[model samples]
Target: MADTQFSLVPKVINGGIAGIVGVTCVFPIDLVKTRLQNQQPGPNGQLMYKNFRDCLVQTFKKEKFFGMYRGSGVNLLLITPEKAIKLVGNDFFRYHLKQEGKKLSLTREMIAGSSAGACQIIVTTPMELLKIQLQDAGRTATVEGSKAAAVKPPKISATSIAMQLIKEKGITGIYKGCAATALRDITFSAIYFPLFAHLNSLGKRKEGSHEAVFYVSFISGLAAGCVASFSVNPLDVVKTRLQTLTKGSSDKTYTSWMHCFRSTLKHEGVLAFFKGAGCRIMVIAPLFGIAQTVYYVGIAEYILGIKK
Candidate 1:
């Protein structure tokens, strides 16, 4: 019975295991998303990203699989905390909440998830900023590269990007878009966790038995993924913008989150808010379901001595 729950490994170990596997699975779409979000307006201030397949093909043609995997090697940044927060912290909340005698509802899930998402932004933002530079041909994070006559990007490394942020902007540079990212996290994770919990519960209607972990897990994942995407689509765009700023730029002029958001919308449009969302929905929504559901039902179960 003890083995029927999470395995004996430390929560961090379990989270690390899940994060590495899950983030690697979804990185390509994430690459495309960063590129699309950071795209500069054309001469007429036009938007980019015609479609997913076109971007994928062109990316492979230009950068090969390497191109498509921009910032991928450094993905440990995004993966570590993301998995830790969701898998470990999220589960922790459920366990704790259960002991409180208050009814477990979607609200608990949302609160746990949102908190984790907020932490993830801090853990992930700089790496994300670097990824944007690698994905786009026209932009780079280095002083010399941004200023060169050709403006060709140097081979910016994840280590270099982290170092550069420290040198240029101090600790603040690394936390560039935290307010926005926090908001994004708060809304989306909040929605996803509770939604998933509810969905997972739906599969248990037939009996109070704990046997249907896989079905419950899948439904929970699917619901959480869909709802989260919808709730925080705009904030995700804002988070990306704040992350992709070049070094030494003055963000002082922007003043507030609304200012930056309005500026993007004014220059772009409503559709600008949803640049790569369709691809994200198609990819991330489903994968979110598969990741957690698989973890709880299949992968974690293996560790827990359950077979189903």
Candidate 2:
């Protein structure tokens, strides 16, 4: 790896921009993924959604175009800090872990990535908890309605959800799935950062720059994002299930990640672990692709005249 002046301001700006762009483009797919993961099989093995496409269609049919972005308010608002912490934290760790004339080993890379992942959980857990509730609310409301009088689900907002959670469970209420979120994010970063770095390194560099060409970085991010997203999907499923606290009485409850993993496997079969794997890959690939492209483009650096 090459050295650049370590500056937080530009990196933070770049990360926030990357997150906003990526999330804007892919939030709908992510919403679908959450619904799929949260959906439980009905009595007699029926599922609300046949698959990702069905889920998308149903959401569009019921909620229309903007409905797909149901929980985007909180996600978009918090993702700036969430991504800023993850990306910038990774860079901070990697820069510190690098030794003079020593190659950055894979283990160290993973450690750096994991550290970044851990650091972001402070923001990620609460953001995801609120986002999941809002995202899955529409689907669950419809399901509950089918068993009773048909009525429109009440409009819910992120602020309302946060306030309710805080009032009920105090501040920690919003971090209902912190442990599961940490597991998913740490594992994802451990896999993604090292792989992205290695693949990005193989690409042709700019004339005198250590950075790979923008397209190469984007492709590297996409590929790594897909693999990492797929690998941690089971954890993501578990996390989503854990965070969604509004399940009906019949829904199975899990006390921990292992318990959820085992229960889901036993009840829904092994495939349950990957309920939204396809949507996850779709959402993550382009998300990281655009994010990496933007990050490497140094928009903040350009605006601030900061030399890398």
Best model number under lDDT? 2
TM-score to true structure, per model: 0.80, 0.96
Q: Which stretches of candidate 1 lie over 4 Å from their true place?
A: 1-10, 99-102, 137-153, 204-211, 247-256, 298-308
Clashes of 1: 1
Per-residue CA lDDT of model 1 for 1-308, tens digit only, reads 11235432456555666567666777788777766665646555443445777666656654566666667777766666666665676766666556344566666656777766766676656655666655554333322232323343456677776788889989887777778877876777777777776666567642545544665676667666777786677887777776665522322235557887998788778887888786666556766766775566445446666543
Q: Report the C-alpha lDDT of model 2 over 77-192, residue by residue, as the tens digit.
A: 99999999988999999999998889999999999999999999999999999899888887778877773333344598889989999999999999988999999999999999
Global lDDT of each model? 0.64, 0.91
State which candidate has the highest TM-score: 2
Assess the local accuracy of residue 239 in candidate 2 as a C-alpha lDDT between 0 and 100: 98
Model 2, total clashes: 0
